[model samples]
Target chain A: MMAVTGQFMILYVIAHVLGNYTIFAGAINAYAEGLRHWPYTIILWSSRTLLLISVFLHTWYGIILKLENRKAKPETYALTRYRSASLAGRTMVWSGLLIALFLIFHLLHFTFQVIEPGIAATAHPDALGRPDVLTMVVGSFQRAGIAALYVVGVLGLGLHLYHGIESSIQTEGLNNDRTLPVVVRTGMAISVVLFLMYAAIPVSILMGILK
Target chain B: MNLTLYVWRQEDRNDKGRLVQYEARDISRDVSFLEMLDIVNEGLVKKGDDPISFDSDCREGICGMCGQVVNGVAHGPRKKTTVCQLHMRHFKDGDTLYIEPFRARAFPVIKDLIVDRTAMEKIIESGGYISVHTGGVPDGNAVLIAKRDADAAMDAAECIGCGACIAACPNGSAMLFTAAKVSHLAMLPQGRIEAGSRVCVMTEEMLKQGFGNCSNHYECEAVCPKGIKVRFIAKLYREFIKAKGNL
Candidate 1:
């Protein structure tokens, strides 16, 4: 259940990052306007619903698995040593919790526009009578603290995906001995590319390159 | 070589275990790890003290009868080596060793360095077999299996059921052992008839045994004495999902 939901969320994140590229193309305001309008609005709302469900299930099962795994090992060794487990593999629960926390803050800051009402896009319309999403996003990223917080959140997502993608592949039995190494490398490559793509937005805006 | 050993000592299942220090003085480096313990046991016997109890049958690596965590690594620091086959030469002179029994909820400590592994037997009994008629002996050439499939089956069949993988896993999952059993059979034509039910039944039994789910840490593969790969686990999932789809 966790793997399925996690992979679904990863798909959503990929689409989200691709959509976010509209800002660089200078069509972010029009794109946001199109999403809020009819027809496209249906896709927007339905995708949001699916993503919300995926997040809830992913976090719920992650916690249950963590608790069950802990219970399975009641007595720990006096000197524990990991042979092949990676640092990211060991701290999955921590990274997952970080992502969950960031999601909440993200929704409040951007989607709901309740966190910073002064820069809320809903209150400021562009010249085309659309929500000034581009300005609002650029304005927010211009702040050093918010940009740093976004960097942290993106890092958490990267670390989570680094382990999560290959884990899901293994869980779903999509890999064999010959393909396992390739799958692992592919997963890492995807994670690094996604991280660079997502983090580049805030970083570019902060450097006054996207404005 | 002389070494200090901090061995876990427990009277019974109810007793809270504690690490008791023992000096293994002037021990020969050529002896197996179990033999070194035997020398310590002999000294305790002479002094009228309760000797440490551990499980071992063949003392050979294939029996899977002996398993203990040496310095926190299951089956010791050597790769793909069981405790019984582990030699004293691996450790340097004057080194301190911490030896503990396999620690998992399913394999509780019955005494010092001996955990009850009946849980694993229960898993095997559930569905780790194939049905064969008791009539005339069948010819070996009756089954003409692909060379690739036969080798893969042999790879998975190498698992010794030592419980070392469970001991090493942070989740204490039995997926590696169960997967090995399932994969070895699923690769054979005879075992394919009951593959669907076998995977489901064994998975159910594993969960019922209080074993945790696999988190893909690959620690089980790392500590496995048989060099069983995690690919067998992936095969187990493949067989399981295919079975579920059919159902």
Candidate 2:
């Protein structure tokens, strides 16, 4: 169930990244406003519902697995050494928690518009009379600290997604010796591409490249 | 090979254990690791000191009896080698070794370096067998298996039921061992009749034994004496998902 929900979230992230690139085309505000229309609104809200359920299920299963793992080893070794386990694999819980916190912060900043003043109240309309989401994103990332925070968040997301995707494929039994290298490469590709794209938004804003 | 050994000593399961240093002087370099311990045990016996107790039947690596975490690596520093098969020649003279039993909640210390590995047996007993009639042996060609599956099953079957997978796993997961047992049976046509129930029961028993879940760290595969691949674990998950639908 955890893997299944994780795959769902991966799909959502891919869709989110593709849609979010509209910012570069100067269509982000129009895209954002268009999502609120009738048919698009239905699709948007349904996906939101699915994502919400996936997050909840993923978290719930993660906690259960963590507790079970803890109970399995009541006593730890006095002196320990890792052979094949990566640092990212070992720090999964920490990365997962960081990602969760970032998600909450992201929703507050964008969906609830609670982080910045006048974000929710003021109507910054574009030439097409659409709510100007591009300006809000640009203004948020223009702040050095916010840009740094976004960079850290993207790094965490990349690490989490890398391990999460590989693990999910393993859990789903989609890998064998012949295909494991491909699976690993695919995971690395997805995480790296997503991280670069997501990090570019804030980086371009902070560098004064995207107005 | 004058080796310094830091051996774990515990009277019983309830007793607290600590590492006791022992000096084995003037040992032959060609002797196996277990033989060196035997020499040390002889000296202790002559002095009326209690000899350390450990589990080992076959001095060969195939039996899966002898194992110890030498220098924090399960089955010693040599890759894919059991403790009994490890020779003192691998170590330099005056080298210090930290010897401890396989540590896990499912594997408790019975005495000195000996741990109770009955948990593994219980998992096997749960569903590691095929239900066949009590009669004459079936013909050799009765069931013709595909070469790929036969080889895959053979790879998984190479697991020697040793608890090294548990000791090596940071999470203490026995997924490799359990998966090997399940996959070995699941791949064969003779065992596929009860594959669903076998996987379900065996996995349940594994969890009940307090073993952790696999996180795909591949630690178990790294320290496995038989070089069992983690791919069996993936097959186990596939079998598990299919089994759950049946259940």
Candidate 3:
């Protein structure tokens, strides 16, 4: 169930991020503007909310299982020497904490408050007169610190992504040798793109290419 | 091949241990594991430093005295080989080996890689014997055991009481070792009469020793020097369950 919820979480995050990608063609302001007055904005926000809940539940299971294993088997092995168990078993708690922190900071930066006041982020119409996202992203990344922070945050997201993404697929029972490597690689590729694309906006602004 | 040994150096059981790296140069690959350690100790002695502390008497695998966590692996990665029988060729030249003691909660570090394995002796003392009167040494054919039963019993009896089972088991349960001893005697016709009582007392003693419970991880079976099967545990469990009902 933890694995299933984790997979569900990845799916939701991917969809949300892809939706956020509309800013690539337009601008950050255009994406926020899209959120403000759009056909699917309500559903977009609702799915993200559900994704947050799934992440919380999955992390909770990881913590509970670690605690149980610690009590049942405190030592790594019979010998006092060092040993490596599963990567997920060792780092799930730390990774889950980082993801939780990133979510809060992310909401504060974009959803609740426009941390940069003077950045022109008005919800304007785009190609189809749907609120454009391109301008909002460009305007937000214009601030050097904000862009750097976003890059670093996404890097943390990347760390969580690589481990969580593959394990989630395995947990969901599609764990055959033939398909497992493919799913793992695909999950990694998706996360790397998410991080790179999200970071590119800030880097572009830093390079004086935007706002 | 020559290797650097990052041996755990502790003066006593209560000492705060640290890695004291030593150059165990010119050691032979064909040398038995303890013999290589003996050469290192000889080097330490010549330099007037304290020799690296480890255990071995028979220098043969039968003593069950030598074992350490070499490079994060118990008994140095040899399948079913005791530390005494393990040769140095398995290690690569110029390897930095991390040596430490077997680390179960019940097995406290005495000094260096040696642990206080007296807990194993206690489990055996609980009921690893028959209470039958010994007037004269009974004839070997008195029990008239079949060959298969006798062979299996001997295989189970081959457990050297090394506590390797305890070290390898993730939970540190001595069930394999305890069960081996139990199965050894219980399979015999003369020993079957007291099988129920023998298993119960030993199991209770195992718990009293503060070892963790078994979780069926099978690492114990993987590292056991005697190659004892987990089936002995099943046999012990059967006798235990029956004993509980009788209680």
- Clash totals, every prediction: 0, 0, 23
Question: TM-score, each model?
Answer: 0.96, 0.95, 0.58
Write the candidate numbers in order of decreasing TM-score: 1, 2, 3
Query: Which of 1 and 2 is the better model by TM-score?
Result: 1
Report every candidate's CA lDDT. 0.92, 0.88, 0.72
Instruction: Judge candidate 1 against the unseen true structure and give its global Cα lDDT, from 0 to 1.
Output: 0.92
Q: What is candidate 2's lDDT per residue for A1-211, written digit by digit as tens? A: 8889999998888889888899899888778887899989998999899999999999898989888888887776656778888777788788889989999988888777789856542366666777778878988998999899888988898998878888899999988898887887788789989999999989998999898
lDDT of 2 by residue, B64-146 (tens): 99888888888988888999999989999999988889998899999988999999999999999988653576688776889
Candidates ranked by lDDT: 1, 2, 3
Per model, how much of the real contact set is kept?
A: 0.86, 0.74, 0.16
**Candidate 1 stretches greater than 4 Å from native:** none
How far off is model 3, as Cα RMSD? Answer: 10.2
Top-lDDT structure, candidate number: 1
lDDT of 1 by residue, B1-247 (tens): 9999999999999999999999998899999999999999999999999999999989889999999999999999999899889999999999999999999999989999999999999999999998955347668877789999999999999999999999999999999999999999999987988999999999999999999889999999888988999999999999999999999
Model 3 over residues B162-208: C-alpha lDDT tens digits?
A: 77777766566787898889989999876788999998999899878
**Backbone clashes in model 1, listed as residue pairs:** none
TM-score of chain B of each: 0.98, 0.96, 0.95
After superposing candidate 3, which stretches have Cα over 4 Å from the reference?
Answer: A1-211
In model 2, where do residues sit more than 4 Å from their true spots?
Answer: A119-122
lDDT, candidate 2, at A57: 94
